[model samples]
Target chain A: MSIYLDNGATSYPKPESVYVSIAEYMRNNGASPGRGNYSRAMEADRLVYMTRKALCKLLCVPRPGQIIFTCNATESINMALKGYLKPGDRVLTTSYEHNAVARPLKMLETDREIKIGLIPSTPDGVSDMEWYQQELSKGVRLVVVAHGSNVIGCVTPLDEIVSAAHRHNTPVLVDAAQTAGVYPVDVTSVPVDMLAFTGHKGLLGPTGTGGLYIREGLELSTLKEGGTGGMSLSPFQPSDPPDRYEAGTMNIFGIAGLNAAVQFLLDTGVEVIREHEIELAQFLMDGLDTVPGVTYYGPSSAKDRLGLVSFNLEGQDPNKVAIKLDRDYEIMVRAGIHCAPQAHHLLGTAPGGALRVSLGYFNQREDIERLIDALREITYS
Target chain B: MFLQSINVLDVDLCVQQPDKFVAHTRASADLREIMPYLNSMFRTSTYNHDAGSIKFTNDKIEYTIIGDKINIAKFINRTELHELLDWLKDLVNDTYDSRSEIIPMYVCRKPVPVLFIYNLLPKTNCQQCGEKSCMVFAAQLNKLEIDIEACPILSEPEYTANRRRLEGAFGAFS
Candidate 1:
């Protein structure tokens, strides 16, 4: 039987409820929300609202209306960046961000004449808070940081970072793509200005579903505006938010799946899932240590990092090792940069990336054991 | 658990107010058993024991429950309608749960007759309430089909006593 391990990119074999909800919505309720006041359309409308409500409960957001739906975390990051940043604004970010945050800020740097500064971090991925405090004092309009690095798998010290930025009267936007579903992302406690997340990763929802939570009283420009299912008479878009940010027909299908996924997360507490992932990540990391010619990246302990780990083999291309594990052992894992060049640059693996085996809520010790066995065999081969 | 869902049967543009919407929905339960309880809980409710019907207003939206059907009018949009439905469903379920504790009112609040209302009206076919004529408005008002506030002329100093009489007969004020 083939084993799926590439959960960091997109979770596989989603919770059965997620699949069932999508099919049920598509087969039974195919009507568009806000298109008409018909029963079915109203059902779709409630379905969308319930999705937002579920996400709010899952993410610990106080209001459902503050969460704006997008196609993915990339769109969320783009929206948060493009809408909030004005011309010649200064943005401070982590060195370990995925391209979702990097590319948009780069585009803004060119188009809007904004400036970007990377927070100084230690070799293992912890941010230099002293340097960060000095930078915050120097004044930045916004601070964007990844809650967890997709490349190295280290969980950033968000409390320290967010507290420092807010002290400086600067708002912070978090790209929580990797940490949202697995970690306790309580906006109530931490009070992040904006938090962007994806549905298909730890959230265990279908692709094309994600959202951004904008704190109350914080309004951002619309990334794109069209039919928002309401207020058609006004030629100009409504001043109220999520409608202000969310325009055009939403992906109700994906949202239905996401609703179920978020409900699953709420039912099965993220704390329980966090404990499980930590155990699995530790097992995988500890197992890799036994195999000669294998070297892993990120923190030594699993508790300090995410459920994913990246590593390399001596004198072997990561792509071929990934392919061999897939073809010969029926094991699936991702290889290469994983689309965060800056993270790879930090790890001194700029061009060539490492083998990444990310765990899921459903992953077991047997799966990691089998992966270890495959790697031990490949070490000699 | 007593009221699980609301099945919306028909949705139409509210005639009294064109910009808003009206929905004809059937609750999972007949809600006949809970009407008295609802009548007890809602101060604004007008319960008619003889007709097995109850009408109430919440957040300026009118709800008339007869048998299993609940007609809701003057809602802004589908989202608000759904929220109202959920609110109503919760209210029904909550009232059903504590039903034994609530005292049921078996009395019918009197419905003002149509001609009586027509006599108080300016008797002009004002059509101010978007109705065709005063008689139609009075008939609609008698059925609780439209709010008494729909008639602007009724507010004038010429009809203060009539307006008070109408409000008293309806047991209501917008």
Candidate 2:
């Protein structure tokens, strides 16, 4: 049996209802959303709208129309970065952000004239809030921070960071790639201006589904131009919230699965899901800590981590360890830069990166025991 | 010298007359048998033994297969060519995989050839070239065989270090 430990990349064996709803949508109502008001097309539109509404409720944002569906977090980030930043403005981000955040910023640096400053994080994945504040003081227009570190799995203190950035009169865009569905991300309490999330990871949705939550009053230009469902009489896309950003036809089947995913999370509750995953992470960390020649990086305890652990063993390349785990024990883990070369650089895991074992709600206690046992075997061998 | 060199050229694959597989659904077991047909129809001219080696390694099995212009030529003649094309279509339909997306071939120009033209211009990424990245401009230059006179950064002493670095990175694509 293969034990999957790479949920940070994408979740596998998504909730049963999610799969069923996607199939049903494709079979029964697979039409271009908002393109026509026919029964099937309207059904598609409603399904996608429900997903936006669910995201609004889940994140405690003010309006459902503010949630714009995107192909993934990368696309969402691109839309936000390109749509928001103009030439000569400054953007503040953390050193611990994933490549989804870093790559877009780098591309923007080349295309648009902007000053981007990195708020450095400690080796344990904790960004110094004071350092973030200092960078925000430099007339920053937008602050893009990750809700959780994809490589190390530490959930940053977003409430404090958002409040600090707000003091500087800058809008904060949180990349909740790992935290959105697993934890209670109350936009009301956190006071964030925008939150970008991937639906396939913790949300248990199909791939090609993600959204950007833009709080009211944050006006961003649209990246793509095309026909929106409403206001056909107007030649240009409406300057409203989502239709302004979402130009092409929405992914109806994907939105159906996303809606089902949100329902599953709401039923079980985000807090319960977070507790289950954190317990698994703690279990794995404790076992790995006890073993000889194993070195785990991140928050020493699981209290600060979401559900991910990055580690390396003595005299063993993380790539080699990952291969051994797969070939011998059928245990899957990701090894290498994890697409966040800067994050790995900050944690001293650059060039050749560390072994990342990220957990999900589906991971059982026995899975944790199996991983520990396999590590013991490799260490002894 | 070319034999000693390893080039990681970007490859774009396509099945000529793909309308045949519009309705085809099954896949052929011998995937290699279908490569030649594609090469012949796609205007592939050169064939190299060491050039088109496709290796999949997992620290076990170490499966090694080679597919060059010649193999793609043979692929065009297989009895199961339709089935092979059908498998590719099915793969695309079932999963949103970019691996199945065909990207055009791009060979990074060698530094020696590039410098002959680059020597005339300032080798800067100052957006004076109207390109976002200098490396991207270099790739475009290779495609057009055009000289690099538009760059503003190359004239500056501060960008002297970057010019050499870009040359080394683009040198591998050759």
Candidate 3:
């Protein structure tokens, strides 16, 4: 069996319930929510509402109605960035950010003339609090930071970041693509202004499912406007959210899958998953330490980062090594910049990226050992 | 059959149609206890269990019941108004008697599309509802701001078919 170690890109082999939920929704209740007064349509509306409530329980969100569904975390980040930022508004972001945050901010720089400031940090994804605090005093409109770095597998200290930004009366937007399902993200405890998450990743849902949680009273301009199945006569969009931000018929099929997936997370518990990941990550780190010619990036301890690693051989190119592993040993991993050039630049591995073996709930110790065995041969052969 | 009598509380000018009137009535029995039963009975209802209110449309009239206070909107005159109230009193008494047979659903049915209501309008832009156009009247109707009977044009003999359609879609025609 080919090892699937690319949970960072998109999770595969989703929970059976996720697949079943999507198929059931498509086959049985094929109706648009808020579009009609039919019983089936109302059922669809209940499914959506239940999913929102489930997410609120998971994220510790205060308001369920503010959670707006988007195609993916990228769309969510775009909604938060484009909708929240005014022309010429200043934003402070981190050095190791995914293209989701980088690309949109780049476009905003040119189009809206917004000044984008980068906060320096180490490869372990800990922000430079001294510099961050100094900049906060200078006054910025927004702070965008990744809750976890995809390239380095390091988790950022969100508690500190959110509190510092809030002290300055500035709102913080977090990209939780890498950490959401595997970590205990309590929005009530942290009180993040806005958070974007992908349903397909740690959430164990299908692709094309993700959402944004906007704190109560935090209004963002709508990115797109169309029929929300209610209030069709009014030319102006609804001032209240979920409706305000969400327009057009949603992917109820995918949302059905997400609802089941989140329910699974709630049932299994994220703390259980986190403990399992640490065991796998520490095992991989331990095995990698034994092999010669392997230089991995990120924190020394597994507890300090996500269940993934980015490593390079002494003389082998990351792409060739990944191809050899797949062709010869039936192993799969990600190579190249992984769509985060800023992260690669910070690690001094700018152009040629490292091999990324991101672990999933399905991954076991045997999978990591197999990966390690494959790397040992690839190093010598 | 708990609600034996429904006393008229007050009467006022319908906001959407000043020619028409909206009336408020106080039910003898607490109607809040049977809201969920009414919610399950009416498919096109917007029920707020927390607010203890259920708003629904029957025939061409709209009714919003909060606790024991009933706000009935859009009737041609006082004669038809009492007839509507009496119809409601009997309907509630019957529903309460049959509560054990029905499954009470707390989930509110989402709002009906204004466009659907607009399609049922006469499209005459006839300022008969005290509104500039029929579309605005349809929007107000969707929000429960005005009653369906506000558009007197729909009551005309020529528009009987449209009125029947409205009654069929919302509730049973009297």
Ranking by DockQ: 1, 3, 2
In candidate 1 the C-alpha lDDT for residue B20 amounts to 71
Model 2's chain B yields a TM-score of: 0.24
Candidate 3's residue-wise lDDT over A1-381, tens digit each? Answer: 988999988887788999899999999999987666565775676688778889989999865676889999999999999999999999999988999999999999999999999998887777789999999999999999999899999887888999999999999999999998998898899989999999999999989999999998889988999886554556877667787888899999999999999999999999999999999999999999877888899998999989989999888899999999899988899999999999999998879988998999889899999999988988777
Off by over 4 Å in 3: B1-174
Q: Candidate 3 lDDT, tens digit per residue, B44-63?
A: 57899999999887766889
List fnat, each candidate: 0.36, 0.00, 0.00
DockQ scores of the candidates: 0.22, 0.01, 0.03
Candidate 1, TM-score of its B chain = 0.63
> Considering chain A alone, what is the TM-score of candidate 2?
0.97
| lDDT of candidate 2 over A7-59, digit per residue (tens) | 98999879999999999988877888766535566456556666777787888
For candidate 3, the TM-score of chain A alone versus the native chain A is 0.99
Residues forming the 10-long window of minimal summed lDDT in candidate 2 chain B: B1-10
Q: Pick the candidate with the highest TM-score.
A: 1
Deviation in angstroms for B119 in model 2? 84
